[model samples]
Target: MLVSLEIERVEPLADGAPFGAVGAYERVVGKAKGEVDPAAPGNRGIALIDKAPRNASGKVEYTTDIFILRPKDFSRGNGRILYEVNNRGRKMLFGYIADGPQGVNDPKTMADVGNGFPLRQGYTIVWSGWDPDAPRANMGLGLTAPVATDSGRPIVQKVRDEFVSGTRGGALETFKLSCEAASLEQPRARLTMRERAGDEPRELPLNQWSFVDARSIKLRDGSKPRPGWIYEFHYEATNPKVLGLGFAATRDVVSWLRYDAAALAVTGGPISHALAIGFSQAGRYLRNHISEGFNRDEQGRKVFDGIHSHIAGVGRIFFNTPFGQPARTGTQHEDHFFPENAFPFSTAMQSDPLTGKSGSLFRGDGSDPKLIETNTSTEYWQKGASLLHTDPLGTTDVTLPDHSRVYMIAGTQHGGRAGATTDAGPNVNPRNPHNPMPAVRALLMALDAWVVSGQAPPASRVPTLADGTLVEADRTGFPAVPGAAVVKVTNQVAPPGDWVNPTPPAKAYRTLVCKVDADGNEAAGIRLPDIAVPLATYTGWNEYKPPYPAGELADRDGSCLPFAVDAAARQAAGDPRPAIAERYKSGADYQARVEAVVASLLADRLLLPEDAERYRERAAKEPRVAP
Candidate 1:
């Protein structure tokens, strides 16, 4: 339970400016102190919890950085709470939901609030650090967790670390380890380099590289590692943290605020319901949290009423284990051996014929909360997102539980950055800049209604085998555009235990992706105006340029290949996709088409009004359809 909350500071938010009907808000910054009984049923499942140091009451103690924003006048505030699990200790809620600028981890000004969507809705915005090893830069929030020991002695374990230099200027002269090395002895560690994940590693001579310190290593002769090369390090490390406590910490913090009267002092008003939204790694954390049964608090109460798991695909965090690394994510071209993608990829129950293990993300207990699983196109290409709704073999679609909904934000990349140009790092084609935030804003409101008032959300929107919109990667029917690379590979899924083995089973789950239209745009999911009235062929996959390994997926990036300007340009470029001039009669015509799609989406409750206007405004200035 949350033992105490140490308030560090409290101040007016955005200079005390009123936000629509929500009135002026205040920010509360503090540290949340909590503990869990190792012998308790709620805590025993935590890895190495029993080995952690205990307090006077025989409880393992922990502290987490907490930040909250709510109305100054408590009675005027919404009784709902929105908690965003920090991604690498930085708060991303404002950037995605509020359309706020990035790198504003510490929001104190009106500009930091962007359009003020959340504040206007009167939500008590909450963020508490759940990652123990989350970086401290950029005012990052992190948890202070206890390390596990064996009978008062340090527990030692072997840890693996991987690094890659994807750019020409990127060279590794020195490398840092997540965990401190137990010894500086060269023989105590093994280092190897490979050009690709599937290639055989070449062991570096001991004389070529030496340990710079217990926590770092350097090349002796000033040798810089080659770009696109994967460096693997295996070393002995001591002190494994009770990382699973992070789940309990989050549960107790939310539970205490909802159940304990002392929470009134923090929230200003009582919080009747809570919702959680996470992106990428944090999103996968939510999956692990629910599957591991952390949704049920120590007192047997549900924690979050609703959850928005975004862009996580069919992955879970490599958390809650001995020497777990929460920062590592498994992608096609990187971090391949991590335990991020494995069995039980779906919330539905299905058996992995290879592993002989059968289970679902939900525990089937009454503690299960309403769930909304959303993903971007990059997830289908690089993270095996189809598994979330498909069977283990990817041959058939599985039905989601009544309380769950899935939506695929079509024609976008992993991080939906705004703007039309693709200036992604180390990618051959322009990266996809088709932001899907507008659709997300609408979905969040729908999720709130589902949890707060038992209102059903919009039906799930995703490509399915039954509809013939989901197909194998090779059969996506992607256009043969000039200089464009078709997806030849997708992330393979193996049993959960295969992550730790040197060689996983050669047999793997079948990979699938959303089919595309004649224009090379995704044919399914929530299509925004940018996709509906397209000027480019946006895709979920981008190829790595030279220096980096060719033919491999450019780490979680998507491609945006714009069509030719006119018929002459189209014929000259041999572009099969119709030219912008040929598709639309005039710029005004294109704007009308975009507005029509936006209006339809709004009627279906898939697009917010403010966001719909933003789309229309952008369409008016679209240069591709200019007269």
Candidate 2:
């Protein structure tokens, strides 16, 4: 396990800038080499591990990219490690949690680290590659894994690929396949197109497209791919990497750092506790890691003491199968039928009536870590988030274990961007830009305390059917706003299906959503100031434009529909909601209301003091009502 770590480069972070009392920090960039025993108890569950090529010692070898930032003087810093799972090989913890700049994969300057929140808190930030197919653009991190073979011979299998073009993608002439084609002449290959997920797929003539090479396909000159249309391809492929080794590699890396004193040479100090945080696609990886029992190292020691999964909803990653594409995920208007949504959605043990399977995310052993699951409103509408708290049949709420806490950050989109105003992409309405980072920052600190000192964090903040806040998707009680469409359809959850050759589900599982007030805002959840105080009617669902399917939910987008400026404007528009002027006497009145809500949130430990001040400053600048 973690046999060697080769340091490639080391440099002072931000040109030796001091971050509070922790002093200057150093960034270590290197490659981590590890080997796993297929016959070992902890590694046996990894798919295709036995089929992978082995070293001289009969152990499977793997190499992964590693990046870490730690205090130069380890004794003065917190003795904890904060590991952030990168999304698509790119890091986002700084931007999402520290209010830092977005899309900086390689950070060097002060601006790159944003406000340096993690450094000031004396955290040893760590990142490692876990996906073999992760993109290498922009210095993206990834693992180099061995392909599964049978007795020195290649293994071939049929794989399926799904692709959906964007609004401006109609001019696109070529699409890349996830796996290489076995031969140039593919007689068994079939290409089908569908208008929507429920519609029947129409087979396209073979003459319409031709294989550009073993790895990509190009459409004929006359045939242009339509936007928002689903395209499916089936072909024979070979050379499937042992992707499941990613789990073992992650476990081994963390285990070596915690139990091995030699790790201090890399970590800059001894790490007593390790916390893992993942966002979006990476978040789903954590669920799979826990469910697959990777938390227990080979030596029976815990790898991570705490886990924070954000925006993953009730799904696990499709990463442990043959020819698996870890980058693909199921969404409403795209990637509709993947193996992400499986049984045992909740943390507590439960039974799936369809498959007759009874289990939970936890292995029921003592290897479970303290879990903090955070989701945005978009997950409830597009990702089957209700199943995380409700039973499989959507009948009643399931109580979470003492070690787990779930919170729903309302009125935000999946990519919680702050200060979003204009409509972008194919959506008809303005996209939701309400930042949920303030709550995220606070919860991260709370999770660290719980793991370090055995202190319980805040109580779970989620809507429940017992309180009448969670109901059927159609019963959200939305107001009839002009030029706005209400959401009645959500992502369907069905029984697990075969990944390579999947068939249609005979029946579907019931899904629910969060109830909303008359103003079309979510009534229950961790309501930020933008939601607690009225500024606009924010919703987790947004409709696609005309070119796309009608009434279908846009992929992971939310809407922000502002209220009328005055009563006259509201009456003229036939809007039932109160006007801004009628709700507040003046601009100052609105700011006061926002301030009060922020103070309450701070007292509840749902917001940090720095974020509270940011909210006040933003509220004072936005004066929708007359002074």
Tens digits of lDDT, candidate 1, 1-627: 999998899999989999998899999999999989888887889999989999889999999999999899877777889999989899988887787888788899999988889899999999898888898776788999998999999998888888786442356668777777888898988889997889998988899888888878876777887777788888899888888989998999999889899999999888999999999988999998898889999889999999999999988989888888898888787788887877888878898876788988888898888999889999998788899899889898999889888899889888785433578567788888888888888999999999989989999999999999999888888888988777757877765554434675566787689899999899999998878889898888888877778778878889989999999999998989999999999988998899899999999999989888888888888776766
lDDT per residue as tens, model 2, 1-627: 899988899899999999999999999999999999999998988888989999999999999999999898898789899998888899988888877888899988898888888889999998999999888677688999999988779888988898878732344567888887887785678888998877888888888888999888877876778878888898998888999999988898888888898898999878999999999998999999899999999989899999999999987887888888888878777777788989888898888888899988888788899999999998988888888888888898998889999999988888785545557567778778788888988898889989999889988888889999988888988899998867788888888777666777887777788899889899998999888987788888888886777677888888888899888999999999999888888778888998999989998889989889988998788757677
Q: Give, for candidate 2, the lowest lDDT window spanning 10 residues.
A: 166-175
Q: What TM-score does candidate 1 get on C-alpha atoms?
A: 0.97
What TM value does model 2 have? Answer: 0.97
Clash tally, candidates in order: 1, 0
List candidate 1 stretches off by more than 4 Å: 167-173, 419-421, 498-501
lDDT (0-100) at residue 303 of candidate 2? 90
